[model samples]
Target chain A: MLALIRSEWLKIRRSVIWLLLLVSPGLAGLIGLFGVREEQPGGPFPWLIALALMTALHAMLFLPLLTGVYAALVCRYEHAGGGWKQLLSLPVTRTRVYIVKFLFVMGLVALTQLLFLAVLLLIGTAKGGGGAIPWSELLGSVGRGWLACLPLAALQLAVSTAWSSFAAPLAVNVVFTIPNMLVANSADYAPYYPWVQPLLAMMPHQNGYDFGAFTLPSLTLLSVVMGSFVVFFLGGWAYFARKAV
Target chain B: MSLRILSAELLKIRRKFIWFLIFLGPIGVVGLQAVNFGLRYDYLVGKVYRDDLWGGLIENVTILMVPTLFIGLAILASMVAGIEHQTNSWKQTLALPVTRTQVFTGKFLLNLLLLLVSTTLVAAGTIVLGIVLGFGTGIPYGVLLKACYYPFLAIVPFIALQNWLSVTFQNQAFPLTVGIAGMVVSMFSIRFGDWFPWKWPYLINAAKEPLYSVACGLAFGLVVLAAGLAHFVRKDVK
Candidate 1:
């Protein structure tokens, strides 16, 4: 398994997809730096508002879309010229290969989260007051955002691996993710919807009326997120194992 | 030769569900509102944008539709070129008597035709949804027409760019990555000015003299189309 992961790492080491991953953080950082203003003198954690506002779209739409794009790009090389057949003929199980590749994609998504966090820290120190930053809230929000992306990456990887055409998975991702803007507004649907989870997890709801009986770290939300991750990851793994290629 | 190539291009996408995708773009945009009004029709109509309901609804749809149009153009362009790429038939197709210009032009014309159909659906969908929701009988036909078609006109340059990118690179990810990033930037470009081509769709709707943006899209699209053709003719198809 380690060797398989190492080989997969070599495949994505020097690809153009890394630069693509930076886009969301880069854009969010720029918007946060210039657009947000100083809070009132005695506010509690001014940086929280800036961080939340900046990451709203990044986590909601752009990051998940980036996940799909990267997953597709990672599988793109193998999909060409019957490479899948050649790869599967090797002395390894398809399940192991699928797991490694999925791990690599999650790693890339984690990198995006870290970069977004770093940019938020930078803005906090530079433009925001030299006051004490809410490191826990910031990291927790971004961490949960990454958690929200796990099922998405799994699903996107499955779709991308299933389709040889690079655009197919991407188009599907865009079509599904665009409506997050609407779904996140719905109290009834937002928590359970995979695409809207990141926004619900990241944004600090004011009324607290939406998630009645459930908080971000509530057992129910965790089970839902983890359950989705398990289902998609295992489902994709099963398909790859039984697939004709 | 041109007619034959155009017919072939059209035939290639048959049974591919590309038409479903074409109409799906507009329906998705209006469908979001369908849900919004369906759930909260009384609240929305009673509280928000009651004056000139048709204009308000159109404006709301356009806000989300710009990004959809931009992304849709990229996907359509990619799907067109992707057929040849997936089949490994680009070199074979170009080797025929048809000029490279005709091949590229055929794809462009098909994309334009699809987008026009999508725009019509959006216009028609908006009107239907408005009537269903009882937003009033006053329909601003001119505003609705402009809202639907003007963005299509303004998106011409992007259509050309996406096609060029898709045709030039065998990998569909490159063009798509560029298109998604362009969509994000265009959301912000509405603040900068009219110079950014990504924001042309929004500018056309928002500009004081909207004709200028429409003119920009038309002129820029023609220029890019010529440039893309010149590049395609000289490059080696692998």
Candidate 2:
């Protein structure tokens, strides 16, 4: 399993996809530099406000969409010609292969979240945010957002695994993603929707409400996230196990 | 011969979902508007649509369509190019008795035609939506047509850029990422001013004088398409 995971790492270490990973952090830094002001309308801390805006951009669109791209690309080489047949014909189990790829994608997502954290702090200090860095809150937001992306990543991996054409899965993901503006606003639908979970979880809920659209993560919301993650992860695993190479 | 390539390009995507996407692009945008209106018909009818039902709908729909247009073109270009890339058909297709520019022009036209249909659908759907919502037939035919096509004309350069990237890279990742990035940037492009390429689609909408973005789109589109043609013509296929 470890070697299989290593092989997965070797597959994408030099690909152009890593450059795509920088988009979230790059955008965060840009927003921090421009969009946020010293004294803003929403809250007290400029850094926190910047963080909130950054979370909205990343969590709503970038995180969910990039999850699809990464999952598709991980399966890219395999989908090209005979990579899948050759790998599956080897002396390894399909279960391990599926698990490793999902874990690998989660790792990529975690790295993106961490990069956002790093950029947040870097921008805060560079802008001379006049207070101690809010380490615990930042870490909590990063971790929560990363957690929210799992079901999305898993489902995207399944679709990517099923389709050889990269853009189809991506197109489907993009269609679903376009509605974040509407979907994230619905108290009834936001928790049930996978794409908006990261935005809901990552944004620091003020007085426990999201501009009157949603509240901070409650028990039901957390369960919904975990529930979808299980369904998608297992569904992808089963499909890969029986997938004809 | 160029017409033949255009027809051939259309044939290549026959069994594919590009056609559905061509339709889906506008439908998705219109459908989102449907839901938005369905959810708040009372509020919109009472407050937002006081005097101008069609105008209010037009404004909301235009804002919604730009991001969809940006992302949809990226996918369309990627899929169009990926047909050659995924099956490694570039060499075979190039071996045909045609100039590379014809082939390049053919694909760009297909992308343009697809989006053109989608854009028209948005206009038609907006009308249908207005009629259904009882917006009272004060339909400004010229205004609706201009509202849709102006943005379509303004975004021609991006369609060119997306095709260039999609054709250049065998991997669809780059073009698709750029597409999403452009979408993100365009969401905020209003802040960046009018000259930013991604901002073109939204910039010309409802403007008093709206020729700038269209002119820029045509000129820059020619440049990017020519640059891509040069690369495609010279680069060895292997």
Using all chains and alpha carbons, the TM-scores for the candidates as numbered come to 0.91, 0.95
Q: Which digits, one per residue and each the tens of the lDDT, describe model 2 over residues B162-184?
A: 99999989888888999988888
Best by TM-score: 2
Candidate 1: C-alpha RMSD to true structure equals 3.0
- DockQ each candidate and list the results: 0.57, 0.75
Interface residue Cα RMSD of candidate 2 after superposition: 0.9
Cα lDDT listed for each candidate:
0.82, 0.85
lDDT of 2: 0.85
Chain A: TM-score in each candidate? 0.91, 0.93
Q: What lDDT score goes with residue A61 in model 1?
A: 74
Candidate 1 ranges beyond 4 A from true positions = A39-46, A128-131, A204-220, B136-138, B204-207
**How much does candidate 1 score in TM-score?**
0.91
lDDT of 1: 0.82
